[model samples]
Target: MMAPNNHFATLGLSIGADENQIKKAYRTLAKKWHPDKNHEAGAKEKFQEIAASYEYLSSKDRREMLERELRKPAAPAPPKAPQSTPQT
Candidate 1:
């Protein structure tokens, strides 16, 4: 099952992403994952998820309402440090 916050995950974006970033990511992914263009086995499902994520993020007025109701952004992840091989 998809997680509750799967939309942001699908777009490879932080949950607090501003609308422009959301739109930009949507356009980039949509072009890449469009089912007819992309023949990967899961491309249709991926495209659907991307379209829905974009729709959810595109609703500016609705987001304002949701933000007022929730009063908090989703947790922002800390940056990851580069991984290094351990001495063996």
Candidate 2:
């Protein structure tokens, strides 16, 4: 599942999406969800989320930081400590 705060997922785009793709997706979603256009229960909230996502991903530095974060490997789990047996 996509995280609630994931901007790429919010815009229905991939992490590797280019500027054009991001702009296109943002426009599409913004149009679809814009509170003025859609009267659905969550339209306003969704539109706001989309706008924030677009703003965040549109920045070159922020986008690069997110890409780097997504590309990073998961940290390895720490080794478990050996359990000692009770001495009689």
Candidate 3:
């Protein structure tokens, strides 16, 4: 799954955007990329992605989940093993 930030980026919004901002961005993007209005290549796919992002961000529960995820500290990276030298 794409990171939460990517969803916000898809709609040209920051993670801090409010519901009204999300709706406005979705409306603008939907009108611009709606397949019926835009015959250009990839319009349908773009519209789909925009719609999905809007839906994901619109739900209060999902938004709360996202906030919780953001609050958690990032997991530590796995330690790298020592490199072995090849014998000639």
Candidate topping TM-score: 2
Model 1 spans with C-alpha error above 4 angstroms:
1-3, 61-88
Q: What is the C-alpha lDDT of each candidate?
A: 0.78, 0.88, 0.86
Candidate 3's residue-wise lDDT over 3-67, tens digit each?
44557778998766789999999999999999999999999999999999899989978866876
Supply candidate 1's per-residue lDDT for 25. Answer: 96
Q: How accurate is candidate 1 locally (lDDT)?
A: 0.78
Task: Report how far residue 13 has shifted in candidate 2, in Å.
Answer: 0.6
Sort by TM-score, best first: 2, 3, 1
Model 3: residues with Cα > 4 Å off, grouped in runs: 1-5, 86-88
Clashing pairs in 3: none
- State the lDDT at 85 in candidate 3: 97
lDDT of 1 at 12: 84
RMSD vs true structure, all candidates: 9.1, 3.9, 2.7
Question: Which regions of candidate 2 are displaced past 4 Å?
Answer: 1-4, 76-88
lDDT of 2 by residue, 1-88 (tens): 3423568988999887889999999999999999999999999999999999999999989898888887777677799999999999
